[model samples]
Target: MRVDVEYLEYLWPMRHYLITCGDFKGTANIIAVSFCMPVSKEPPMVACAIGKSAYSCGLIEQNGEFVVNVPPKELKRQIYYCGFHSGRFVNKFQESGLTAQTARSVKAPIIQECTAFLECQVTQAIDTGDKRLFIGTVLEAYADEDVHKGERIIEYAAGDFPRQVYGGRFA
Candidate 1:
């Protein structure tokens, strides 16, 4: 019985991702997100909604680039830390101890501990009430061969495979 609530997550157990924003020389920030999804294939696009006032949001708006990082379950603690803390107060990388490394086609760095990453340059920005959704074309992507057994990251998001393998809230 779905009861009314002030705020509720429609997809509570959705796949979570780490978004790295801004250039190294500027204000770089990392935040955990669960609203990310693939939008297209021909031009290769993905979109994620970020809070309008978030540090990462401003960085992505100014820099027009970000990295979508896919972390293994081992980094769940760090992910929780990122989701709770603000990058405006603390350097998430330093505080969370998540290593940031250069990405191939974006100024934003990728998390070294993550199993995969997508380097993107924003092509569209849509205002959605309190949050802004940024759509980016996936410029470059990388996956750990040892972890994925050589499976391309894009393949996992292709059809019914993701639904079959992913989705479980931490209860």
Candidate 2:
């Protein structure tokens, strides 16, 4: 039997987000994609893939700044809203009822609901077939007050991952 990549495309959308801001200044459009990873550690680098048609792509390319926000489990509803709907019509923040906070080094606002936030400045962008690969340097990073020593970062595996509470034990 032969396998076709196109046939498996429907199996998943790989639900993760690659948020970006700073194109239009006040109105920073954030993108939600499944591609995000740490590329380097010596200088602290991260990378995410953004489709060309994605609204945030233009903003990121033009301004070269963005905040990588990892939304917590509690914000699943908001994440769904932002991930599915286009920012062209409604203000995702207002629609989803998520608040925005400013980062330390960049002008882009960070999503306050996320457990962890990475303030990054774009270092390079590479063309990767269908999507643009954005490499950024981490300028600043911090976790929310709610996360404890035993708490694990919110993650979406298989389907909707359940939120795990931590008591005090360190991993």
Candidate 3:
């Protein structure tokens, strides 16, 4: 069967994360992202695709830094909230009751509730017409002991895939 390119979102399940960014000494914002991945290893880098109009995109551009927080399946509601609402109007952390922990090398705060964090500094920005791809160098990476012991992190599939596909067993 031939598939419509526009409906290609079903091709694969994407992992969801809470990416935080802001000024060096100002308000911080969190946005849910599924289009993020590690692009390099030696100088470790990751690329995150964000809509140009997203508030967090502006913060990342201004600060040149961000934190990728790997959330667990339990935080699904919070993830949805961040993805659907605009951080420009609401404080996602406060509204979702997620704790923000100061990162070691970047100004952006990591979500304390997440299983792991990747603090990054922007190295490049690629324009893809509808979205901006920010390639960031990982300055620091750490994870909860449980995560090291094989705890599961969240993955989004728009409810198309079975939970087992993303609930750690497959990861």
Candidate 4:
């Protein structure tokens, strides 16, 4: 069965992550993203693909820092809210009821409700079609010991990807 190359996103089940970023003064934002992954382990580097028009994109560019928050299934509603709403007008932290905590390495705030957090500083930003891939060096990492005791991280698959393949399993 030949498949269209455009459907390549269905090849793998992507984990949903709440990426938080801001200027650390009054411009804080959170967005749900699945197009993020670890690119290196030795230096602890990770990359997240953000649309050029995304509100978080500009915030990240301005501060050169961000936090990757791994949320559990319970926060799925808040995750969707962040992804659909624009931060330019809405304060996601206040609306989602997610607490913003100061990160140790970066100015970006970590979501206290998340299961895990990765404080990162942007190492590079590469243009990739409609989205810019921001490669960040993880400066610090922390996680809830109890939540990670088993497979507890929430996963997501866009549109029909879940029905067409692996049923959106988590890693």
Predicted model with the maximum TM-score: 3
The ten-residue window of minimal lDDT in model 4 covers: 162-171
| lDDT on C-alpha atoms for all candidate structures | 0.81, 0.70, 0.81, 0.82
17-117 in candidate 3: lDDT tens per residue? Answer: 88999843567889988789999998999999899999988888888989998888788888888988898899888899998888899888888888888
Model 2 ranges off by over 4 Å: 5-15, 23-25, 145-148, 151-171
lDDT by residue (86-114, candidate 4, tens digit) is: 89989999899999888888888888888
Quote each prediction's TM-score: 0.83, 0.78, 0.85, 0.84
Task: Report lDDT (Cα) of residue 79, candidate 4.
Answer: 78
Candidate 1 regions with alpha-carbon error over 4 angstroms: 5-10, 150-171
Model 2 Cα shift for residue 87 (angstroms): 1.9
Candidate 1 lDDT: 0.81
Better of 1 and 4 by TM-score: 4
Every model: Cα RMSD to truth: 6.2, 8.9, 6.2, 5.3
Which lDDT tens digits does candidate 1 get at residues 11-93?
44467688999876557789888789999998889999999988899999999999999877667778778888889999999
In each prediction, how many residue pairs overlap at the backbone (N, C-alpha, C within less than 3 A)? 0, 3, 0, 0
The alpha-carbon deviation from the true structure for residue 20 of candidate 1, after best TM-score superposition, in angstroms, is 0.3
Question: Which prediction has the highest lDDT against the true structure?
Answer: 4
Candidate that beats the other on lDDT, 1 or 2, i.e. the better one: 1
